[model samples]
Target: MYVRHVAAAAAAFLGWALVLSGGPATTATAAASGESTTAAAATGRDPVRLVGAPVLYAHRGASAYAPENTLAAVDLAEDLGIDWVENDVQRTKDGELVVIHDDTLARTTDVETRYPDRKPWRVADFTAAEIAGLDAGSWFTPQFAGARVPTLRQYLDRVRFNQQKLLLEIKKPELYPGIEQDTLRVLEEAGWLGEQQVENRLVVQSFSVDCVRTVHSLRPDLITAFLGTPAAEDLALYAEFTDRINPWHTTITAEWVAAVHALRGVHGEPLEVDTWIVDDPAVARKVQAMGVDGIITNAPDVVREAVGGF
Candidate 1:
């Protein structure tokens, strides 16, 4: 029954794309005016019209087509018309931010086989160079042989050069002592932190309120998203720290969406709600029908088609 629902949703999204062609003309005009103006205008109930084209966020840089969290994956997402490239950030032994989804490096890389004696905590003991030496891509596919782990700087540089927006997830802040500082420093060094204009393009997200709060305090203009599956009572605490809430799709009810929109940020504006890892078209449509601001997924092309027709 579940599989059948997923297929029907996927099919519906595919069929919907055939009906819609491009983004709303109003949104294009708004994007041209600048991020602040556009974001401000979008705050209204109508905001920037989704016009059925859901915001396409490339989950782990389009993991479906390329090695997750790699520069190659981000590039492929850009090529495929993805609006935002999402990636995870973790600190290396030397206090540098690197992009990788897992802390152990077991599932995505050959680290486990190469260093069986070295436990998962061993990652924190190794320098970035040593960590980078592990083949991160081969495990994903034989075709992507020799793909190495990329530093956050390399990842950000590539994305900036490509003019792509980024959704950066700070992973396990407590485990990495100075990960937040290092991450902030890297973005600053890359000239991604200083100015107001650049800040709008970045969305920093984390499950930890402290992590997101730290970033918000340092770079107040930088958009911060609280990533969690919390009860209604817990949401008020989250709202105090972040501009947006990125809840697990399953946890998001229609009432939750309505409630989230009712709560105002520090600026006295409605909070933006984004749900993650939604790949099925019917669920996507249901979420859209519920009026979610964004949906993150591995199959961005599928979501794009679903939202376009919606």
Candidate 2:
């Protein structure tokens, strides 16, 4: 996993370099007033009319710049005026909901140094308090030496305080049975679901189809997305519950996107399509041209600037 992270980070840097060599994107929001007043106004001339702007979700809370799933990363996304930030949730050994990505704590935390004997340091092996004690940011940079793991409550508070929306991902939820219910219970306690406008501000997504079904069955009022590639039959089945079908970039195409657009959704909206981890300017523009409504990116600023929109 650490090897994968290094490879991804290196690729991201190279993509940025290629983007830098180019002059500037013609449809960038800076020229919003040149012809069409806003990104929405410009969409009519294109293949798809999105909700408002090109929706950009700061993948893993602007993970490209700051440590992923930390307050520092989320705050940086907010500071950049990004409307949406994404995060992952997993349970600790004591069944407490904490925000982190991997099933283990090797790449982003000091778990190996702190507990050398614990091979394959699974998150569920330690209590939340014990998990919280590890330094989460120093691995990224010394400037962020003391960042700690945040509880789900703290993560929700940060998102709410920023006045931003969240793409809440239930990570590896199958490992902890009934985590879907536990997640909703935590959100209910946080005033994030079941009673107010907060529900509208969240889009619950999961790679696990079972987890997606759990969220859909439990609270259909809240938006839900199915992440990863799904079979054609699976897509049709999920269309009943999921508001969006967010596949990987590799699986998406113009025809697939158009087909999804034609499908009627039970939620009274178009079968919204979104895709992830796009960073290069050329790729971002291609995604937009493919009729994708949203772009989930680690490089939020570049996507919003080069791809042009929110």
Q: Which candidate gets the maximum TM-score versus the true structure?
A: 2
Q: Which structure among the candidates has the greatest lDDT?
A: 2
Question: Per-prediction TM-score, please?
Answer: 0.81, 0.82
Question: Candidate 2 local accuracy as lDDT?
Answer: 0.75
RMSD of each: 10.2, 10.1
Question: Please, what are the lDDT tens digits per residue for candidate 2 over residues 83-140?
Answer: 7999999999999999999989888899999999997999999999899999999987
Clashes of each: 2, 0
> What are the per-residue Cα lDDT tens digits for candidate 1 across 1-310?
0001122234335334444334433322332233333453354223222333446688998777678998868876765556588999987778767899888778888887777877763556668888888888787767667888899999989888888888899998888876777888888888777564355578889998889899888777677888976677667777777778888888887677766766765434567777898888677877765556778888665566566521
Q: How much is 125 displaced in model 1, in angstroms?
A: 2.3
Residue 130 error, candidate 2, Å = 0.6
